[model samples]
Target: MNLYDLLARGFPADRSRPAFLLGDGGEVSYAELEAGAAQVAGHLLARGVRPGDRVGLQAEKSVEAVTIYLGALKAGAVFLPLNAAYTAAEVDYFVEDAEPAVFVTDPRSFLAEAQAAAPLAQAVPRADDDVASLIYTSGTTGRSKGAMLSHGNLAANAVALHRAWGFTPDDVLLHALPIFHVHGLFVALHCAFLSGAPMVWLPRFDDAQVIAGLARSTVMMGVPTFYSRLLANPQFTRERAQHMRLFISGSAPLLESTFAEFEERTGARILERYGMSEAVIITTNPLDGERIPGSVGYPLPGVELRIGGGEETGVIEIRGPSVFSGYWRMPEKTAEEFTADGFFKTGDVGRRDLDGRVWISGRAKDLIISGGYNVYPKEIELVLDELAGVTESAVVGVPHPDFGEGVVAVVIGAGDEASMIAECRRQLAPYKSPKRIVFVEDLPRNAMGKVQKNLLRDRYTDLFTAG
Candidate 1:
């Protein structure tokens, strides 16, 4: 099944049922959603879009954004979602790489800019086997590479999730994430149509608005940051969330404390799952079994995961239907990322317990080497998080003349330097503890709320100069 067919199926059976609800505005029924998508598809078709073409969407989270996404699919064109926060340079990189057939933007201010950037391609209706999206990586290493996700790839993953999650027609989803990300676009929006679940889209996350939406939603998916904000609201009550059946957390680590506290307060276990842009979802805490804390749980039905390198610790390699085809026009990078056996090397270091729960240690690149001893920052960060005054912390390896690399901790919290040092020494091993602790007002974060460790490293490299 193609991605657009997911919505087509729902429209026939539940034409009058609500398909999308805008928080401040009103709702759109399944029939209305289909009609809007059709209209948008017609608009693209009239603009000269063709099959196998790439289309750019730079709209905020709303019915229009969702409609444009479906319309692109129906037109047989690949839909490239641009992060609204991205600068023109970043946007230029993706536009040039994908060479989209048409560019759709909100705010109307960017329409001229996008058109100027995309001069050659003419927009028209979409066709099958077209490139669906070119989702760029976070560029942790160097330049961001666009992963070429096909229409078939997205549809298959959505179908897998629809089956795995057991989403039904009666379910109402609270769509609170950014549309540009894979979690919101494919996992939430596409899965809703694939499973015929109605959804309410919020332009941006607001604590009280989310609580109000929860009263009418049966399912909600978000990153740990969204949950943290929701938990901060004083008026939030378990009774309000009683209607919500499934609450999923992804995009970053959901602290064990956050998980436990949320469950205690809301009577709903935050089902922590794992995925990346290269592949959609690889593992998830079981829906029926105990929602294990720390671990992202077992692999989904179609995904194959193995720990490679050493027996104790290795990179998590995954082979699955949901994995992206390759990076757009970057054959060399694509060849480097996957193994000879076809599994994608996720670059993430992870370990599995005897019971099959998988705990992600950290990114392989983020591993800190201090005095020739290897240390995973996530381990130290978790320990620091256990301390009373700590809110968030990032561990990095700074340049050290004698040791080669020294462990440095950049933290955001209320505690004094001495107290933090004592807490780290008490909780972690000698080598794992931070040699120098720097307290900052706030850590630099990406649009997705992930701490930009590279920026932190650049900011704190001076400390290691004298060491």
Candidate 2:
């Protein structure tokens, strides 16, 4: 039941086939990938990493970094990937919490040592329910909790996404995403591995590099910021993206304007899906169907989704084979997140149609209660985004004198505050309209391009309270 074995079964018969096409026009063959994993596995075993041990990696993205992940899988060790941008203090927290057998900051030296060690011939055996990875939540609210993803959890998700996206050996993926996140690590890499396909790998998302890679690649999976940046560049023409078969967006909400303008510019609709760190990928807009803007489409094949509170719109709860068992070492906290009936409460506020389509409004934490009325930030932001002179907007609730919380709109482009407020007043209820519009050149964002609303809330907490 080892996940490494399942992925290995899909390796190309001709091991000479390219698995990674690097930026320097060099190629890493499938045979080399397998060998690297074997050596790394052996090195981990020699270093006293047992089957259930944790292997923490916080290095920059590279072929060696990916090999470490596969190596950990082969050794039956739980992989813990962290963002490279985290400070020493931040790394300290994860270290004290997860306590990996070996935390490697210098991957190049580690790979050198691994290459010199004896190679393990095959993957170590693991049960289906054995923990495979620990994906820590972003922890905007409190301390980060490690989500325990089992071998069965990851394997089920990998296989489901592989079929849904229609991967084939002939496909050449333009891989520009960071490997730390689920969108890049599990979803993108698994699809390519499952089909024995090659990936035109880039260090990160660069407009020029991505445009050039598009000529030789058939598929591209990226966050919303990647698509928005591409559209901003004049070189990203229809002809440049004409040959691409799929452009999938996730890890953040895609602006409807970005969705429409991308279609207008490239003549291809971006497939936007919804997922989080707890679950790899829960729902996706159809690979072949009407990909309605603002909809995350339907639940994956075996997932059972329901709206909590039994309203048209409430919290989304899900139960499935891919849903993680619980958070690592947080039994009480884990119990609080799941329903009594066993559904994992996805703190996102959304609704499901009778036909099974799902549309996410916003995060439950982001919901604003103003003047004794509930106000959803997404609704206000949607209206603000459509107004003139506004490139984008983020609506957040701040402490107020009159209302319990005042609706404040933080905008990204030029606009008159009074005029914008008047426009909002016309379209929305008085309480729903922004009490103050704070214009900023750019909104605060995390690595994956999701607006850090918590930061926004903190930054403007005194907006209505300052004397």
Best by TM-score: 2
Per-candidate TM vs. native? 0.92, 0.99
Give a tens-digit lDDT track for model 2, residues 245-339.
Answer: 99999998899999999999999999999998888999999999889888998999999999999899999999999999999999999999999
Q: What is the lDDT of residue 391 in candidate 2?
A: 90
Model 1: lDDT equals 0.79
Which 10-residue span in candidate 1 carries the lowest summed lDDT? 114-123
Per-residue lDDT tens digits for candidate 1, residues 1-467, read 45676546755375887787777667788877676666666666667887777878876666767777876777777778888888889888878878888887762443223233322222343333446777888897898888887666676677777776778877888988898989988899866876666787788888888998888889999988888888888778889888788999998889888898899999999998899998888898888889988889988888888898657777899997778878888899999989998989998999988887889998888888888898999998888777777777888888887677888888777677777777888887888888888877888887777788899788877787853
Rate residue 335 of model 2 by lDDT.
99
Where is model 2 more than 4 Å wrong at Cα?
Answer: none
How big is the positional error of residue 175 in model 1, measured in Å on the Cα after superposition?
A: 1.0
User: TM-score of model 1 relative to the true fold?
Assistant: 0.92
